[model samples]
Target: MNFSAPSGEVVADRLSDFGIWEAEYRQTLQQFVQEVIQQAETDLEQEPAPSRPTDVDLQALLDDLRAEIAATRFALQQYRQSLSD
Candidate 1:
């Protein structure tokens, strides 16, 4: 019954089942792949372009950063002194 000739259609039935399984598997895989591709494309499109350094004032930015650092250091020193007291 399970011969190569499919004496009682046994082998033939198995072949049919295999075919159906392959079709479903292929379709599901394709759908998953397409969804990932679409989402990646959408993310890329929504993201903004990066800023160029030439477009900004380097000196002004450096000054601002230095001021912020000084302020933070002062705050930290004040807090530590308060804790010691």
Candidate 2:
């Protein structure tokens, strides 16, 4: 007869539904934030990898420096011999 106002049972059911919806919403929001953080970290690591020199590059540089030092030593020896002769 008085259908305008919801019954007590109806109000309680709606409140329960609202609580469940709120909990699900909070969980989903937290999961989304976690995924965003992980993706940002991955991007940052990748950005630096190309800019940082690898072990192979450093080894190559060292080899070139040794070769240059050897060449300089040979040149100095030849110059000393010429001077003495």
For residues 38-85, write the lDDT of model 1, one tens digit per residue.
999999999998976677888899999999999999999999999999
Clashes per candidate (backbone, < 3 Å): 0, 0
**Candidate 2 error regions (>4 Å):** 1-3, 49-85
RMSD of 1: 5.4
lDDT for 3 in candidate 1 is 50
True lDDT of residue 52, candidate 2:
57
Q: Residue 81: error of model 1 in Å? A: 0.3
Alpha carbon deviation, residue 56, candidate 1 (Å): 1.5
lDDT of 1: 0.93
RMSD (Cα, Å) for all candidates, in order, is 5.4, 15.4
